[model samples]
Target: MSGLGFETRQVHAGAIVDAEAGARVTPIYQSAGYVFDSFDDGVERFAGRSARRAYSRNDNPTNVVAARRIADLEGGVDGVLVASGQAAIAMALSALAQAGDHILTTDRLYEGTREMIRGALRRQGLEFEALPIDADEDAWVAAVRPSTRAIYAESIANPLGEVVDLALLGRVSARTGVPLVVDNTVATPYLCRPVEHGAAVVIHSTSKWLGGHGSVIGGAIVDGGGFDWTAAAARFPHLHEPRPHGAPSFAERFGAAAYSAYLRSVVVLEHGPTVPPSSTFLLLHGIETLSLRMERHVANAVAVADALQDHPAVARVHYPGRADGQAERVARLLPDGAGSIVSIDLAGGRDAARTFLDGLRLVSQMTHIGDVRTLAIHTGSTIHGKLDDAERAGLGITEGLVRISVGIELVDDIVADLEQALDAVLAAGERTATRRSAAAQLEAVHP
Candidate 1:
């Protein structure tokens, strides 16, 4: 399978036929528990002596299929599926860090991730620091503290359209003995494999591109199988500590898959954030077409961004494919494609932004990105609206900012919808200005 190409991997990686039924499609094992052959087998399973399903909360057949496929696709030893992207991050962080421990994160992360660090994790007695994603290698090394357990960043930052230099970041990880945890949701495994770039852990929100049609919400954590967790025993006491049934030490027992095994066995089993079997099936269905779907998604996004740049009402368009200020970074890291998302700033303010949104007929006005349907969202008024003016500015989100998740639709149709919407906004502004002037003139004549 390692010798197979990506197209072959996408179609055949996760789904091997069911042992009993010989089913071609991965069967959904929706049952909560599996029957053990005997009392001895059940005891062995509980003691971690035998490898079989003890409970659905611990593992599921359908979910494992998706997990195994993702692991193979990303070149990881093992992968675990969670309820959502945030869950994946939370579980990964909890598995690695505890009270008094710290993590270094990129400043350009998703707002939800930033909020989780600043609002919740910090309150729990953990320290999280933010650094510029495009910082110099020396600057990143300088930011590391003795308490730092992991360096976290997105492979490609959402909305901002900036790509982190994974290779350089990997070097920083190697120098400081920190495992780099990358959110590979935006790029997916098709465009980039973070493990090859030196990431110890790769995380993805399968709700986005992985579940290509945006039907199911899921997340995955892939262990890169390279980091040496045993040597960092003092940094990660949880992995070194004893287990309930005197199970083997995580690093010694699981080897390269220590992080992933800990996440599923401890974090998920104890907390129970299991992805449903139906959702798992939906995700599996989407993954079969991942390579094909993403190609069109990237192509369509580039064309839409090109059209966006020419519109008069558009102040600026942020698409990595366009080769602007972040062109060097895109060229270096994402030479294949910029990705499916495009962030734009309209000339008019919030009101005009709303007008443009209302004027759209072909595209959907939804918050979620990376779907087959073209979608648009104004962050200042929707997704990032909770942030204060200063906070929004720090995030590079303006009052006029709108994020577009370009889909695999016809390029001409996407451009036409945008063009007409911008025209309608300008037309409405002219009418309002004319009315205001007429009222002022009338008042002067009456006086």
Candidate 2:
């Protein structure tokens, strides 16, 4: 599998032939528990002395196959399948940090992730700090506290499309001995592999591009298996502390696989955010065509961004592929393309945004990204609606901002639909202005 190319691996990496039926594709082992040869075998499996599937909550054959495929794609040493992207994040963070610990992240992140950190994780006694994405290495290092357990960021940020400097963060990770965990949901393994740069862990929402059609909801955590947890023992006591019955610490027992082992055995098993065999099947099928879909996705995105940039109704276009301050970083990180999501701010603000969304014909109005169909959403009214006006503004989610998950549809068709929608917005704005002028004149004459 290590010698195989990405496309080949995606199809065959974790697949196993069914001995009894001679099935070609991986069969979904939908059972909750696997039968053991005997009591001794069951004990050995439970005690970790033997390697076999025990229970579906922590390990399942179907889920393992999908997890392994993602691991291969991300160049990770090991991977874990979970119920959702949020579960992947929570499991990864819980594996390393406990109460009274801190985690540093770039301000640009998915709205759900931001909510998770500030809401649930904060309630669990973890502290999170958000810093600017373009902060220098020294600034990032300075932000690190003695209690800092991890550094987190997205490979390519959502909506705003900011690309992180993985190498700089990797250097900081090396100097500070904190593992860098990246959410590679938007960029996908097809566009970027965070581990290749310096990330110790990578997360993905398989519901997005990995599932390809938005048909399934699943998530995965890929461990690079390179971070030395023992060296950072003081910062991460859980990895260093001995097992309850005098067994070796996770760092001592699993070595490079310590964090992954802890996440799978302790966090995922106990927390019960397990990925189902059915979802894994869909994710595996989706991954088989990941490379092909991503190529078309990127091409369409470039076309859409270009069209949006010159539109009269658009105030600003937020796509990394464009020439901007982040252009160099984008080129270095996303040579193939910036990604399939393009966000634009409408010139006429909220009312025009509503009109544009209402007038769209071909593009679907939805919250999801990475679907085969083009989707659009007003971020200010939906994803970031929970935040106050000031908070939303700070995050670059303006009232007029619209995020488009550019699909693999023909470029001309997509552009045509968007152009017509923009035209509707402009016309609506003109009508509103005319009505206001007429009302003001009538009021003055009557008075």
Candidate 3:
């Protein structure tokens, strides 16, 4: 499996064959608890002396196969599957930083993540600071305080599609002695593997591109097993300290797998955002065709972006593959493709957005992304609606911004649908101007 290709690994990497039934596909082990052979067997499993399923909350065979497959795809040592992408982020961050600790992140992140960091995490005593997405390396390093325990960013930012400078951030991580944690939800493992650059942990909303379709909602945390948690003992005392019964610390017992072990055993298990076997089964099926779907996704996205750039109603297009100053990064980091998401800012503002959205014939207007069918959403009124005006502007989410999750549909059909919608927006704008001119003339006559 180590020397195999991506497509091959997708189908065969973590598959477990059923001995009695000879089942080729991974069976859904939906049992709440695995039966023990004897009393000693149960004690050994409970005491951590043996490796076997004790409870579904901690681990399940079906979920384990899915986690292993994702870990292999992302080039990680191990992975943990949770209920949703938010759980993955929470578990990974909580495992590394405690109350009163600080986290450094880029400004352009998923709106849900922003809400979690500012609302839930802050109320729980964690502190967070945001640096400009295009900030200089020196500035990023300067932002690191003694309490800063982790550096976080999205591999490809949502809505805006900003590509992270991984090499520069990797250097900052090295200089600051803090692990870099990246949310790779937008750019899946097939497009960009952050661990290959220098990320210690990779997070994914399995509901997105990884799932290909919008059918399942899940998340995963992948540990690269590269960060030295013990070396930074003072900064990460939990990993360095002994267990409740005076057992060896996580770092001593698990070595490179310390963070992952802690995340699974303590954070995920205690918090109870565990992914069920059924969802894991769906996720595994999605991974098998990831490569195929991604190829079509990238092709359709590039075509749609090219068409949108020339539309009369579009003020600006924000696709990385088409943007200036992003070519070099795209060529280096995302040679396969930039991604399938394209966002366009309308020239006529909110009214134009409503007209375009309402007139669309083929593209479905929705709140989700990374589906087989094209999906559209007005970011300002939806995802980023909860943010203040200033915060939304800082993130480049304007009143007229519309995000398109280009699907694996026919390119011609997608373009035709978008063009028709844009045409409707133009006609609506002309009607408004005509009405305003008539009102002015009436006012002059009355005066």
Candidate 4:
């Protein structure tokens, strides 16, 4: 698998040839539990002493194939699949830090992830401190405390497409002795491998590009197997502590895959947020063509971004790899492409956004990204709607901002659809301006 190309690995890395039925394609092992050989076998399985699985709550053959495939792609020693992207993040963090622990993060992250940090995770007693993405290396090291468990950030942020400097964060992680946990969802392994850039654990919303189609919802947590648990043993007592059943600690037993083993056997098994094997079957099919779909996805994205840049209705385009402050980083980190999310800020604000959305014909108005179909959404009114004006503004979710998840459609067709929408927005804005001016003149004349 290590010597194999990504295209080959995506298809064959974790596939199992069915021994009983001789099935080639991985079958969905949809049963709730595996049949135990005997009472002793069941006991051993439950005790984590057997390679055989006891239940589908944490271990299913189909799901395991998908997990290992994803891990192989991300250059990780092990991987765990959960029900959703949110569940993946929750389980990954839970495995590292518990109540009263702290995690440091780069400020620019997906809104959903940020929400979890500030909301649910905070309420659960885990504290997160965010540093500016551009903060100096010393600043990052200084931010880490004795209780700091991890450094988290997205390889490329959502909607805005802001690329984080992973090397800097990785260096900071090395200095602070905290593992770097990166959400590589937006910049799927097809575009960037964060583990190569010093990430200790990589996270992904396989519901996105990895699953390619918007069919199944799943998430994966991958352990890079690079972080030293023994050196940082004092901070992570659970990994260093012996099991309740008098078994060796996770670090002692699992070696390089200690975090992955802990996450799967401890957090995921206890929480029961297992992704259905049926969904994993669909996910496996999606992953088979990830590289192909991503190539078209990125090509269409760059085309759309280029087309929208000087459009009269667009105030700014949020695509990366352009002539901007992030150009250098984008070139270095995302040389393949800046991903498919191309967000635009409309000059006409909220009303124009409405007209634009209403006028769309080809692109679907929806709340998803990395779909085969191009999807569009107004960020301020949807994903960030719960926050006030100040909060939205702080996160760069403007009144008229539209997030476009560029699909694998023909570049010309995608641009044509977007152009029509922008034109409608501009026309609507002009009409409103004319009406306001006419009313003002009428009032002045009457006075």
Clashes of 3: 0
For candidate 3, list the clashing residue pairs, or say none: none
lDDT of 3 by residue, 389-445 (tens): 998887888999999999998999999999999999999999999999999999999
- Whole-model lDDT per candidate: 0.87, 0.91, 0.90, 0.92
* TM-scores for candidates 1 onward, in order: 0.96, 0.98, 0.98, 0.98
Name the TM-score of candidate 4.
0.98
Better of 2 and 4 by lDDT: 4
Rank by TM-score (best first)? 4, 3, 2, 1
Candidate 1, position 390, lDDT: 95
Task: Give the per-residue Cα lDDT of candidate 3 at 222.
Answer: 96
Q: Which 10 residues in a row give candidate 4 its minimum summed lDDT?
A: 315-324
Q: Global CA lDDT of candidate 4, please?
A: 0.92
Q: Against the true structure, whose lDDT is highest?
A: 4
Q: What digit string (tens of lDDT, one per residue) describes model 1 on residues 6-106?
A: 88887788676899989999888889999999999999887777888799985998999899899889998888898999888888788888889889988
Q: Which ranges of candidate 4 are over 4 A from the true structure?
A: none
Question: Over 4 Å off in model 2, which ranges?
Answer: none
Output the lDDT of residue 137, model 4: 91
Residue by residue across 264-320, what tens digits does model 2's lDDT show?
888898999988898888888899999999999999998888888888999999998
Give a tens-digit lDDT track for model 4, residues 270-308.
999989999999999999999999999999998899899
